[model samples]
Target: MTEPQRLSRRLIEQVGCSRREAELYIEGGWVTVAGEVVDVPQFMVQDQPVALLEGAKAEAPEPVTLILHQGAQVDDRSALASITPASQAAEFDTGKRVLKGHFRRLQCLAPLQPGASGLQVFSQDWRTTRKLTVEFNKLEQEYLVEVTGTMRDGGLERLKRGITHKGVELPRVKCSWQNETHLRFALKAPEAGVFAQLCAAVGLTPLSMRRLRLGGVSMGKLPAGQWRYVTAQERF
Candidate 1:
């Protein structure tokens, strides 16, 4: 006889989904084994059966480290609005201002356009979020920008030093030339408001801006408007 194969209910646990979700998937005839659908959660097969589901793409279920490529028009208020209230409440208790403070502290690495997309990380807890935001202050943020006119050699350098705007001392940034038409710069605590300050400092309005990297993270292969879980190793 063929070797007896064993299966357990624990497979649902290992799949990083609730047993109810697993059961629903199984009942919906979405699960497959070696390319064959298995609609029964209690069904047993070999130690490993090729598992696939219609909407059950395997993802890193742990917390995520995000790298967003933001465009020119997106703002923080809109971005924060995308977060679901249910998820927010699950992560941090509702009706608690302290937790709201933690959420309010989430920062963006680049300014995004209304229609642009990039990477963004959601921390599992406030502590992890603080770590990522703090790391951004020390690390460099790179951007690929397009302006209205030709920029001088030191045009970017002036941005790196400091610029006063609206009677406020805007902090200096680290910038350099990526090409004659494209400028790259790194900033500490880059947020949506900083983009206006930068535009005022450079004396040129931003036509387009997209974040390329935050610290060592890049938006590699991640599609727009989609999210992936951040693993522990990817955390700051």
Candidate 2:
């Protein structure tokens, strides 16, 4: 049988820490094996070792990918938590957590008022959470917008040139006018929470905004309150 290794070596080998750090960590009672605490740096070990560091057991959450058909009243909070079959909607509110984690300096997109709906894409990984590709930024987001007043000349031009709301300048949006009162827009930058910002710029209160397509993937008649996974070919 192979000779059993020392506790410090076992910790360093399994936990990917420096030998000196492992010794100190083991001596300080910060190492555990098989649910039994081992505080001796020189203690002999054999077999499989489950090395642990204090407060280090929390595994990073697995990354999830999915598309969300945002409802009129839905906000970032609701979108992040709304569950689907493909993705495990995190229980923790991402908006609230991001604010606290980022020293309260994070900006949030405005929420969709009651009755507006659209597609939203999101992920939980910190590294890729803010990536536009993950949230349909690269894909064309087609919106079915209903306006109370008729779209006069320069209305489409105004949308393409971008609009300012509350003194904040919003980027120009790509759109195709469907009719006198309806238009379809494809927003390039799909930030986490910018639906309300778009509405503000358009001078419309979002009487009703429905997400028709995300990243070339359309709802295609998925009725309200239902969702489906985007297949490989479906992704644009």
The most accurate candidate by TM-score is 1
In angstroms, the error of model 2 at 55 is 43
Q: After superposition, how far is residue 124 of candidate 1 from its true place, in Å?
A: 4.6
Against the true structure, candidate 1 reaches a TM-score of: 0.51
Query: What overall lDDT goes with each candidate model?
Result: 0.53, 0.55
Q: Write the per-residue lDDT of candidate 1 for residues 5-24, one digit (tens) a residue.
A: 32225346457667667665
Q: 135-202, model 2: which lDDT tens digit per residue?
A: 63465566776655444457567778877777977767787767755667677544543545665565
- The superposed Cα distance between candidate 2 and the true structure at residue 203, in angstroms, equals 6.9
Predicted structure 2, TM vs. truth: 0.44
Per-model TM against the reference: 0.51, 0.44
Q: What shift in Å separates residue 161 of candidate 1 from its native position after superposition?
A: 2.1
Clashing pairs in 2: 72-116, 109-193, 117-209, 118-211
Q: What local lDDT does model 2 show for residue 231?
A: 38
